[model samples]
Target: MGYSPSIYKFVEGSDTPVPLDMDVVRAVLSPYDIGDPNLTVMDDGRLQCWVRAADGSEAEIFVDEVGILVERPHSGPGVFAIVAELASRLGAAVLDPSSGVFFCSREAHACLPVDMRKDVIVIEMTGEGVRAALIG
Candidate 1:
């Protein structure tokens, strides 16, 4: 099986992880064509998904009270762009639990080669967020 890395993204720079509105995420992610035909929040109160635009890679992007979770086969540039934009707008960072990295900005994610992308990196948060360090 593939690594199928799952990463969480959170808005930073606050004492608490900012809550993510599933509706906002739904609105922002409209372009991705995530396999949710109805765009309805599931009974679990999260978005369940599969990515059709990424060569049928089984992927999911969901939000909870604290943040967003993304599970995918691997990193794709197109997907990264969308996520990066989301992060940029929200002052968030993608946290890769597998590897202690926080992709600080959209450019950070864009520069990393796809095959080398095990996960997202962390950034520094002030009022909101930005993660740019590696953790053990």
Candidate 2:
């Protein structure tokens, strides 16, 4: 899935509004809790995630505070494991379809004193999942 920074404007006042920049968002979001290392941290400090679509296409997300890389037209094994790892790390949950499209939310993750629950929208991938979704 492709992300535009403007998607966050809807939740301007939400507790976990989406990140304005893709890089900052990845730095903040959480991941799932399965095994097999769905998400991985590169030696360069970048995060990688994988998402498999129903049509046999896969989405790979590479995120960092400085850049965001979303690759499409690929697929492999352990797609769910990658998503689960991302959810666990971000204290979030994922709803994915075998067709390859998926949604991720971190509202249930660790909440701070001023945080509220809201469905932060993001695509599930094999690399680092999301940036952040806040409560408006």
**The CA-based lDDT of model 2 is what?**
0.38
Per-residue CA lDDT of candidate 2, range 1-136, in tens?
3331111211323444343354334443333212224367889876666545334445566666433344442333333344334444444434322223224444433231223223334444333343222101
Task: Please give each candidate's TM-score.
Answer: 0.58, 0.30
In candidate 1, which residue ranges exceed 4 Å CA deviation?
1-12, 21-23, 54-58, 106-136
Each model's lDDT: 0.49, 0.38
Compare the candidates by lDDT and give the number of the best one. 1
Give the per-residue Cα lDDT of candidate 1 at 92: 53
Q: Considering every candidate listed, which one attains the maximal TM-score?
A: 1
lDDT score for candidate 1 against the true structure: 0.49
Candidate 1 vs. true structure, TM-score: 0.58
List all candidate RMSDs to the true structure: 9.0, 10.6
